[model samples]
Structure formats: structure tokens, C-alpha cells
Target: MKSIVLFGAGNVATHLFRAISNTRNFRVVQVYNRTPANLVPFQTLVDTTSKMEEVKPADIYLIAVKDDAILPLVKELIFRQALVVHTAGAVSIDALENLDRKGIFYPLQTFSKTKKVDFKNIPICLEATNPQDLELLEELAGSISEKIFRINSEQRRSLHVAAVFVSNFVNYLYSEGEAICKENNIPFEILHPLILETAVKATGMSPLAAQTGPAKRNDTQVIQSHLELLTGDQQTIYSLITQSIQNLHGKEL
Candidate 1:
């Protein structure tokens, strides 16, 4: 079995530890975090440590920390022979350039410690400077997930930006929708079906082809009505998005 030392105790790390532990081919030897309190969750399940010196030798050192923390964390590791990979999406593999066996093992999905995700459905994006290391990552990825992609740093960076637009930006829009509903004394849950349907349709067909509503139809009367109902900040956001939709659909105003 391939032994792994996972760094970080965040959402991604928590999920990965669970998913990887389920597999028979790999085992997480230890979980490392700078803060001792953060290691509590893993202490009962695996070897947990707050010190870099206490880290045990492993076949793979999986760093699942924040993007900014990646480089600084890697510089502190003394293991040069083991394959070291990070779970960051935008950060390039160049961040680990100082190490011999360096790669990226980015999972393309939003993570939350409270939510359980099926790693089998989630896409694991892998990149490595060495061919053998890339194959090793593919093997490890396949152990937990069925979907795997060999993406270079440039492509991975672009994918990360696109993910932010789809996941992060769209979540912000959902919060705005909820706020509007709450202000009107309407149950935000009323929009649940519409939200699910929209998501399903977008996935099943081209989003442009699936497009509908006042913005896409350029229904100026309806658009004006929406703007009038919104707060100042919400009105600005509504106007901007409406204009963007119209522009994409080859319409103005």
C-alpha cells in the first residue's frame, strides 16, 4: 500500500483523508497542521502532528493547505525523495520547483467539512514533472475517483478561474436571491425547484441554449420592474448581469 502524509486540516484535507482511507491501495500515515488544535479530528484516526520534524517518511506527501501557504510549507519539508503534491487549483507546480518529485493533485469541486462528497463523481486533476510520478498520481486518484484528468499548470489555472465563476460567483448570486426573498417576506425555499432545474438544464445542455427569462429575452419592461424592486447594491448587480446576458445573446438594452 502507498503511504501518504497529508498536510492541512481544512475541508479538502478532511474529505481526502476519509476517501483515501476507504481505499485498500493507499493509507494516510499522518496528518500535519501547524495548529495543534486543528489536528484533533485526525488524532484518533491517524498519526497527527504539529511539528514538521515529527513527520514520518511516506511515499507521497499530500499538501492540502491554502494557495499562499503552499510554497512556504514546502520549503520547510525535509523529504526530497518522496513525491510531493498540493491540492491547490490555481497555484502552479512551479511552487514546488525546489523539490525533486513535485506535482499537483487538484480536485475540481467545492469542499465543506460538514458535507460528504462522493470522490468517485468528483474530478481529480493531476500533473507531475516526471512521467512515473504522474502515473503514480493517476493510480492514487483512480483508487478513490473514477474521473481523472491530466492537466498542465496553464490549463489547470484557467480551469480554476472558470470554476470560480461557476461555483463561487454563482453562490454569491444565490445569496442575493435569498436576501431579496427574505426582504419580501417570501420563503427562499420556494425557489428550490427552479434552482435545481436550472442547474440540471445547464449541465444537460449548453447554458446559452438553455437561457431564458427577462434578461435573455431582453424584456425591457420586466427588467425595469426587477431593478425597481431591488436595493441599490442589488440593482447594480442586476443591471450588470442583465446587460451581460443581453450582450452574450446578441442584444442590447
Candidate 2:
């Protein structure tokens, strides 16, 4: 069994801490947070510390802080030769201690602080400075997730960029739809079956094949009605996505 230390108590860390603490091979040996108030919830297994010197030793150190904070935090603490890794999808493993040894353990899923994550189906993308450590990461990440991918820093960054469009931006469009429905007194439930069906179809069919809407059908009257309903930025998103769907179908939308 390997001892593990967690270095954040935020959404992703909270979810991971609960998981590691319950797993058989890895233990939450310690945890640290800069804010004293953030230390309270994880006080049980974590030896709370605002001071870096107070953070203890463990086989692996899981740095789960926000991306911008990672570099400065790494500069402040010395890991005492323990393996260290971070969970940022956009940041690279090279951003960690290049000389001291580090890796990446990025989970490809939207992690909302209030929502629960099903680790079973989530894909974990991993990379490391050393092959042995990379193998260890693959093993550890695979234990929690069935999908494990070994990708370099550049590929990870590309995946992150695409994720912003597919995950984050798509959710923004969903919110736009919700707002339009609410304003017209139309229940959003009418779109629920369509949304779920789209997702289901995309699983076995290409996103291009799953594309459906007045845009894909080239029903200009329906598209014009949807455009008229939008006021500002929503109208822009509607125009862009509809254009994209049209381009995909190689016809007017």
C-alpha cells in the first residue's frame, strides 16, 4: 500500500479525498490548505497547516489546487523526494518541479463543487517525467477509472481546448435555451428528451451524424424564429452554432 497526501480541500480535492480514503491501496496520509478555515473539514486525516514546514511526508502528494496557484505553491514547499502530481487538465506536468520529479493526473470531466462525480466512467489522462512514475499513475488512475489515457503535454492542452467548446460552451448554450423557455412561459421539459436523445445518439453516432435542428434541416423559417427570440449574446451563439451545423451538412441552415 502507498501513502498519499492531498493538498487542497476544494471541489475536486474533496471528491478525490473521499475516494482515496476509502480505497484499499492508498491512504490519505495528510492534507494541507493555506486558509485556516479550509482546514477544518479535512481535519480528521489531514494534519492542517498554513505553514509548509508543517506538511508531513507521504509516498505521493496530490496537488489539487487551482491552476494559477500551482507554480507559486510548488515554489513554497519542498516534497522531500515524494512523488508529486497535479490534476489540472490545461496545465502540463512540466509546470511542477522539473528537477524534483512530478506528473499529471488530469480527469476529463466537469467538476462542479456542489455536484457528485461518478469516477467509474470518467477518463483519467496521465503523464510523468519518469516512466516508472507514469506507470504508477496509470495503475492508480486506472483503479478509479476504467478509461486511462497516456498523453503528452501538448495533446492534453489540445484536449482541454476542445473540452471548453464541447463541455463548458455547450452548457452555456443550455442556459440560453433555459432562459428563452422561461421568458416565454414554455417549460424546459420539452427540450429534456431532445437533449438526452442527442447525447445518446452521439455515443454510437458521430456528433456530425447526431446533429439535428431546424439548422440541419435547412428550415430557414424555424431558424429565423429562434434568432428573433434571442436578444444579444444568445443571438450570437445561435448564429454561430447554426452556421457550424450548416457547414457540417454542406448546405444552408
Candidate 3:
């Protein structure tokens, strides 16, 4: 069994730490976090060290820290060896400048403390400096996920950018919808079915192909009515997205 040491105690770290702790092939030998409170439950699950200087011997060290803090934290850890890795989509392996074996194990999915992620469906994008290390990463990734992709730093960056547009931007639209529903005194739950349906359709077809509603249908009267109901910020977003949708189908909507 290959032992693992994980850093950070945030959403990604918590999820990964639990998975590694449960898997028979792997053991979460140690967990480290800046705030001891954040690492509370994890400490009960496995050995934990709050200090970066208290480095533990492990086959792999998974750095799950934030993008901005990763470099500084790595420097603080003061550990010269061990297969070091980070879970950042846009960060390159060279970010671990002082380490020989380095790589990325980016899980291409949004994580929330309350949300349960299906590792089997979430693709693990991996890359490493050494061929042997890369093989080891693939093997490790396969343990947690059936869907794995060998994405280099550049491709990972591209994928991250697309993710921002799809997941993050789409979420902003949902929030806008909720606000509009609130202003109209309509229960936001009424839109839940439509939102779920839209997501489900996108799984089987491209977002473009799954497009529906007045925007896709070019129902000008419906569009204008909806726009009329919206005000200020929501109306601006509605207008922008509507124009984009019309451009999408190469026709006026």
C-alpha cells in the first residue's frame, strides 16, 4: 500500500483526505493545514501536523492549497524530496521549483462542503515531469476515478478557462434568475425543474444543441415580456445573454 500525505483542509482536501483514508490501497498518513480549526475532523481521521516543518515520510505529498498560496507554502514546507504535487488546474509542475518529482492532479469539478462528488464521473486531469512519475500518477488517479485524462499544463489552463465560462458564469445566471423571481414574488423553486432539465439535457448533447426557451426559439414577444419584467442589473444581463443567444443561432431572437 502506498501512503499519502495531504496538505490543506478545504473542500478539495477534505474530500480527498476522506477518500484516501478509506481506500485500502492508500492511507492518509498525515494532513497539514494553516488553520488548526479547519483540520479538526481530519485530525481525528488521521495524523495531522499544523506546522509545515513537521513533515512526514510519505510516498506522495498532495498540495491542495489555494493557487496564490501554493508557491509560498511550498517554500515554507522546507521539504526537499518526496513526489510533490498540486491540485491546481492552471499551475504548472515547475511551480514546485525545488522538487525533482512534481505534477498536477486536477479534478475538473466544482467542490462544495455539502455537495457529494462522484469520483467515477469526475475526470482527473494529470501530468508529471518524469515518465515513471506520470505512470504513478495515472495509477493513483485511477484508484479514485475511472475517468482520467492526461492533460498537460497548457491544456489544463484552456480547460480551466472554459470551466469558468460554463460553470461559474452559468451559476451567475442562476443567481440572476433567483433575484428576478424574488422581485416578482415568484417562488424560485419554480425554476428548479427547468434548471435541472437544462443540466440533464446538456449531459447528452452540447449546450448549443440543448438550447431552449425564447432565446433559442426566437420568440420575440416572449423575450420582450420577460425583459420587461426584469429591471436594472438583471435586465442588463438578460439583454446581453439574449443578444448572444440570437447570435448563437445566427438569427434574431
Model 2 Cα lDDT, one tens digit per residue, 48-132: 6777887788778889998998988888776558888999998977788554668998888877778888887888899888898
Q: For residues 1-253, could you state the per-residue lDDT of candidate 1 as single tens digits? A: 9999999999999999999999999999999999999999898999999999989899999999989999889989977789999999989999996788999999999888998999999999999999999999999999999999999999998999999999999999999999989988999999999999999999999998988999998899999988888878889999999999988999989
Q: Which 10 successive residues of model 2 have the least lDDT summed?
A: 92-101
Ranking by TM-score: 1, 2, 3
**Which is the winner by lDDT between candidate 1 and candidate 2?**
1
Candidate 1's C-alpha runs over 4 A off are none
Candidate 2 stretches greater than 4 Å from native: none
Clashes of each: 0, 0, 0
User: 34, model 3: CA deviation in Å?
Assistant: 1.9
lDDT-superior candidate, 2 or 3:
3
lDDT by residue (77-182, candidate 3, tens digit) is 6665678889998787778876788889999889998787777777999999999889988888888888899999888889999999989999999998897788
Clashes of 2: 0
RMSD of each: 1.0, 1.7, 1.8
Q: Which candidate, 1 or 2, has the higher TM-score?
A: 1
Backbone clash pairs for candidate 2 read none
